[model samples]
Target: NDLRMHFVEHSTPSKKNIPVVLCHGFPHTWFSWHRQLPALSNAGCKVLAPDMRGMGETSVPKDISAYDVDTICRDLTGLLDYLEIDKAVFVGLDFGAFAIYDLALRFPERVIAVIGLENPAAPHNPNKPPLAEYREMGADHFLHINYFCEKVGRADDDLLVRIDEFFPKVFWALSGEGNYFDTFKFPKETHYIDALNDPPSLPWNWLNIEEMQVFIESYRKSGFTGGLNWYRSMDIKWEQRKPYENVSSNIPAYFLGSENDVDLKGFHGDDPISLLRKQFPNLRAVEMVSSAGHLVQLEKSEEVNTALVRFIDDIREEL
Candidate 1:
């Protein structure tokens, strides 16, 4: 577990307000928050965007057990200690969102508040382990969760070898215009590559050619094992979280997402926001951008920026 993390940091002059740490989700690096770094830092808040765990410039560990939530949260807490940061406002999306929420729960003393974009609470179901449900969900259709849990390198080889076909289609599939769930219609026998089709040539309204290539080239170099390892660790995380099954956090919280966000629409169960409110009584705002998708931050940068500034401001004022 020898690791080195790369992060983008913006210093703030405010003494009362704490720093803000931006965490990116799967298949993404710190560059995922390129839009937010300037905006949030411009608002007089310190910002740190890290290439979490195995993605981007960060070190990627081959061991599947290393990606568990305890170790992931420990990394963040360790970062805070290294920076001499007493506490900070943590904001995240997708896997990033789950990381920060777990951070708040595990090290409540080190977090001023948390803002989650596109994902609400940690994925939990007290009744049964999550993969059981994910497997059940994928029984009749092709579900990425169940698909990812394949014997070590199955999806990895299918995706990495077909890198040309994977990124654009997956990006578009999770966007407002495309349907991620459509891949589910493919029969179980289909490989992940065949199940995904080509997206209408890049340069969409949200992402440009250069922007998309950054992800493509980076993933190409990194091999995506580290990122996929996050998915591989889910069932393990579920089992480890038994002690916290009924635990809830009252740390101030907020959410930002796209109205058509695939995670909200499919994964988080119905009434996810209501579940959020119950988990965090001080939950303030749940901003959903219209006509946006899973990559809501980049898809509608302006809207996400406005909500982020206000959310950070509210938390800062309280500090």
Candidate 2:
């Protein structure tokens, strides 16, 4: 259904049948996990990373509904079916992580293992605050989530530059300064003054320039609407997930977050280990790597990779 899917396989074939399906989050493509592909592939798992509905080279859907989590998750299942694989270890980061949660719950048998990189939300995470509350936090700071919805047509209109050219700069600015545009191009020695003057930490600054550019190019051509469409479908997602309201995933699960990842700290409002453990009682491992930030796989690949390998290795027989 989606035409933009630019799926990339690893450089080598798997020595075993331990296949893995990796997913990317909003404002990113499968390219986000480029560093981990070869490592995982060499570790005896067939790894496949597809550009989710509208992010990378994936087909862009005209009907925004096509971007809904149910359909997007189904797209991954369809890819597996196309490959004739029964199930695989699924990994997602940020919005990609949310999609994985829905996938595991909706089709438990198809998921061998569930891993979330940064923003991990289980079926139990409370409903997000109302739009009004998020809006009060200010439009510039977090406009990406609700930009496509009807409520903020004004703000959307305000940011109407071509998505391709505009988003990279936006991401660069957000990732660089922390909160939106609080501190763009200022002296580091002036951080205290900068904080007092423009407060958001420029979280994207965690990424190296090259990494940020990769996202910019991918999102620039792909457009963020399809990815952003995930937010619009929240109501449909809620109703769809309601059937599984009582479901608690029995699959081995792991949640990894960076202690210094401002995105997670700013978003979750609690210690990730405590929050995720409480939400997922059967969670096998909850790891926090202090050296890393939002892009755990990119920032601290070895640590993230080691933790991931151990978890899957321990659970392979069950899978």
Candidate 3:
């Protein structure tokens, strides 16, 4: 893919434990796992949180096809190769979860196990192309992914200029305290800003204004193009996975979800965990943190850390 990746790495004193890689999803970066970084390190594991694909300090590709899942998995597996790590347990949040899941499916020998947060599996429907369905969903109402897909430069234009306004609302909107689905109340033609529910003035519990600026500053320079590319390549990713529609992965897997996260509520059908299990037959733990949203890692850091540490402990023998 010829992409330059930037990552934050921490090695435990012994450096004998299996390494851990953290992958972030759209509108997020490696820093998104700030709280979990030390927790994992203190748990006697080496941690590597790479700014996946197009987000953060990583090189952003102009070609949309570059963001497809296959390329993304190549980036991860290649990362492991370069680091001389034969295998590492992967922890992923949001779309990042899909990246690790795909990596495991394609390169199972390279993955020790997987710890998925928020998004449980690589989202796909064998019946129809993903973009077509998103377009259909956006036909009558505002769907953020569809906006990112169809609007093209327009979505980037609107969001890049509104980076300041977008973060707070979008952050709050995706939080357990916020209702992301409420944005659908907006008309089809609505701009993303107007559609977002106004968040309570900054420092709303889980995130403070200072913490929010980290995102604002990063996105202000990076723009939304790279992240949005993930949405645009939805159909490309779907087509790439056509052969494994009914296949199951035996990789050791664990899931951490939130009760109110939008992805949990409706996006992946009624039972995403059950659906995830169908794909990862060796699935071990399923923990759903209460009072958390899509950003469960940030909202419930303690719980998320506990689950991650326990998962690593449970799999230490394998490592």
TM-score of each: 0.95, 0.78, 0.97
Clash pairs of candidate 3? none
Q: What is the lDDT for 150 in model 3? A: 71
What are the runs in model 2 whose C-alpha is more than 4 Å off?
Answer: 1-4, 122-133, 136-143, 148-211, 269-279, 317-319
lDDT tens readout by residue for model 2, 270-306 = 5555555554567887778876656677667788778
Identify the superior model by TM-score, candidate 2 or candidate 3. Answer: 3
Can you tell me which runs of candidate 3 are displaced by over 4 Å? none
Residue 151, model 3: Cα distance from true site in angstroms? 0.8
lDDT (CA) for every model shown? 0.85, 0.66, 0.87
lDDT of the structure predicted as candidate 2: 0.66
| TM-score ranking from best candidate downward | 3, 1, 2
Per-residue accuracy of model 3 over 153-255 as CA lDDT, tens digit each: 9999999888889999998889999888888888877888889988899887788888899988988878889999988888888988787678788989999
Measured by lDDT, the strongest candidate is 3
Clashing pairs in 1: none
Off by over 4 Å in 1: 12-17
Model 3 lDDT, full chain set = 0.87
| C-alpha lDDT of candidate 1 relative to the true structure | 0.85
